[model samples]
Target: MADTTADGVERRLPTDEARELLALVRDIAHREIAPHAAEEEAAGRFPRALFALLSRSGLLGLPYDPEYGGGGQPYEVYLQVLEELAAARLTVGLGVSVHTLSCHALAGFGTEEQRAAHLPAMLGGGLLGAYCLSEPSAGSDAAALRTRAVREADGGWVIDGTKAWITHGGIADFCTVMARTGGPGARGVTAFLVPGDAPGLSAAPPERKMGMKGSPTAQLHFDGVRVGGDRLLGAEGQGFAIALDALDSGRLGIAACAVGLAQAALDAAVSYARERRQFGRPIGDFQGLRFLLADMATAVEAGRALYLEAARLRDEGRAFGRCAAMAKLFCTDAVMRVTTDAVQVLGGYGYTADFPVERYLREAKMLQIVEGTNQIQRVVIARHLVGPESR
Candidate 1:
């Protein structure tokens, strides 16, 4: 049951197992996800049941180690799965990516004891997670965050402050939180694993978003929330580094999602063009529409290639941050263009709720803003090319 792309872009999967995994993903996406996307999104319904289904199917932990109940698949394979999910619905794909990001600190830097205690449940026990880094005042300047975690005499910590724009905020089971434990700047930060139901830890109402209403984005408040010393992830003052590492991988996820979104838009436009007759012939027969479709298809393929190249570099243990940033910038921008063209091809119907293109157009805007905005990505790429800008 191999899936075929309308654009004829060949996926270079590493093994038979990867191909089988992709087939399963596509089947689940088309059957369970795509069919309900529009209705659920319109109702602002968060699909917790679908997430449980994904967890039970071993789709939640593909990029993690099998020792902790994960599938132990490579990033390339995992990202392609994300693409399939995003093509079905952005809420599901981005939710998985955020869950992965939430688990990163403990998986990559936790002690043996901590990993033994938590990784199994987080990876496969149906627990959903969130990453808490950005605060009310520290969106782009993440290091300037004011969330504070203070040590107590009994080897415990008390955390206080608010985290803004948190995905899955109210419903997540656990959160990986970054708080200031020292003086100032990036080096002052420390990471901790906090239980969602901890005393004084609560979430504000979800945001009234323009798109992705099916996914909750809210602010989490920590009002003297307490945790044991063992909850500290990695060493104190190393939280910022851990966050940056997680973001490098997360950017690749965003790039893959953007490519999937563009692919979906292109498919919709091509199908509409081939069916809708304008002047005793299909609109697709017109040269003007044909060129638009060609450009849209080309952008989708190019975006896919860029993300896969970054994923390969990561799998091969090479320096790929610059590549990841480039992919995020280019692929998200491509989706913005591709989705807009899709709406154009659909004409007036595209602008209404009667078609999905308008929804895609709305969803595409968020990709350009998340996981570091496109402007920030360009700054990161420039730093790799000619070193950091002088202060």
Candidate 2:
């Protein structure tokens, strides 16, 4: 209900509740996260310890029901916390997002029996989970997934085939897997909770990736892995819809990460322009360069606005899928543009690992590809505007 002009002063500072929570996030990100980001990223290490710290800090379950050891914060607030973590390090933020996405099926549609059984470890962050919707054959066409889960004589199911591009694949305690159970297309799909260490469940070597290196990606092989009927999330034929719903939220998380990455890039660019000397003058003194910084900063703010708007819609329990797609497309492209220009603003220095800009550039790239590619986002937006029944 209140707004503030540019500069540190606020016409209305956040409410006491919001400010307190955001402060906690900032403290953790600046003190605990910023210090180790570069080193872990350089070493390509998955920070299992960092996740535990986040869990202890009450962040791992920030938007879930408190009955399950969660913080019960609104998505609007939770997303801001994610943004701050991402500004410090994209890997940890993305890992949190993936973990949250993995919890969606169980939380949204699971039976009371299922929730009671799984939500404690998941919401408590004692164990991490991966959402397995993408397969070797089904990246964007998720309904086309080829993996199968056949009912066995014992009334259990045996899962077969592989899931590709799974984040946290090697380290996740379990996976929310989608497999074919009926006829072809979306109607055939069912969701299963498959443990990572289950017999016949193995991860391929971590993928050689472009960025978010500290967050590993791999293929999960399921060679007749067995799961109880109780492990199935929701009823048969609902998995595809559930997967898309999860992504609607997951894409918003990616959008927030992009905003944070853009903000970090803008900060670096501003600092560099102010301090770096060019022709016996600060680069900030040059209007040509200063304008670029202005644009980057503007994009950062705009991206924030976009994600926050979508998040608010989500919190209101409104239809926000189209908004999520728009946020993902715009925010990630903005991050790419801003980080690339941040490098240009710093000249040769930005191109090197000596500064974080290069890393930011590399990191911004995956934001476009993950959580559905920007191209896919455009298609989603187009569909929503024209309506599915439209010609």
Candidate 3:
């Protein structure tokens, strides 16, 4: 809404059509989804109705080629949609992000035939998809995953082992499963598209999480789950590379979500600071509180700038992985800081569920952990800066 784009950077806003669509989506999210977020979150019930609305609106397929029933929107535009959705409810926002991540493997690696066969179902309906990468023994060290997929005589692969911390595990209609197919380690892993109804494919009960209670997380057990050869994504031994690439884009989405969450918290804080009286004046007028607002607002702007830079690099097909990781690390940390400070601004009210700042704090914590922890993000950034052979 302002000329806030960084210097020497092209301030590219969304096209007219995209702006209109975004407005519509934001309106729907605020009017329809935001109102029920607290109730559904407190009840720990998934927002099926919200997702049905999103799917019908063709948001599930944004950023994909329109020929496949996708919105054919740019990643930059699609990410803003995610941000708006997240401001209404983190559960729906993160769920959509994970679903988009799950679709990444197929869209990026699947053959034409595979795209024709699977993209429609994934993009057209309310069916959700899970990304199976983290195992119980391996979270950040993805190379240590134990799930295996052995080739059968009929050219199908029999997958066996358990995948842990799988989002949408119990509810997804399909999953992009990463399993060890050759030997132990990252170089031996392979990706597969597993149907939810496949025999021997089942999920444990949803995990009890500290936040994001509405989205299901669980352990997915693959016991002799037979998947056809065509289900294999990309080449064998390429899973790690594909996974890493997907994460680069995924991290950008997380950064955008964090920005949105922080914005919501900041807006809430500002509104409260202005109305809540203290010392015969609104707290916002006090220099101390005003400086806090300044810092929060500044962090939001910086986070927004970093994520947008990463998106521009990605859109240009440049090496954006390092930048993406940087954005993820900085933005998530900004969110944690800003959201916590927001609660501070609200004083005791922030501590209670009476305000949304408390929920923002919980949601911010998960952003640091998922899509590779903030620690891993630093490592990614450092590695990019200092080559393997460098000191």
Off by over 4 Å in 1: 1-8
Error of 1 at 316 (Å): 0.6
Each model's TM-score, in the order given? 0.98, 0.96, 0.96
Question: In candidate 3, what are the lDDT values of residues 1-391, reduced to their tens digit?
Answer: 3222212212345577777777787778869989998888888999877777888899898988877778888887888888778888888888888999999999999999999999987886777888999999999999999999999998999999999999888888999999898887789989999998999999899999988888889999998999999999999999988898889999988998998889889889999999999889899999999999999999988988899889888878889999999999999999999999999999999999989899999889999999999999998988888865455
Pairwise TM-score winner, candidates 1 and 2: 1
Query: Highest TM-score: which candidate?
Result: 1
Shift in Å, residue 202, candidate 2:
0.3
What ranges in model 3 sit over 4 Å off? 1-12, 389-391
| Alpha carbon lDDT of each predicted model | 0.94, 0.88, 0.88
Give the clashing pairs for model 2. Answer: none
Q: Which window of 10 residues has the lowest lDDT sum in candidate 2?
A: 4-13
On lDDT, the leading prediction is 1
User: Which of 2 and 3 is ahead in lDDT?
Assistant: 3
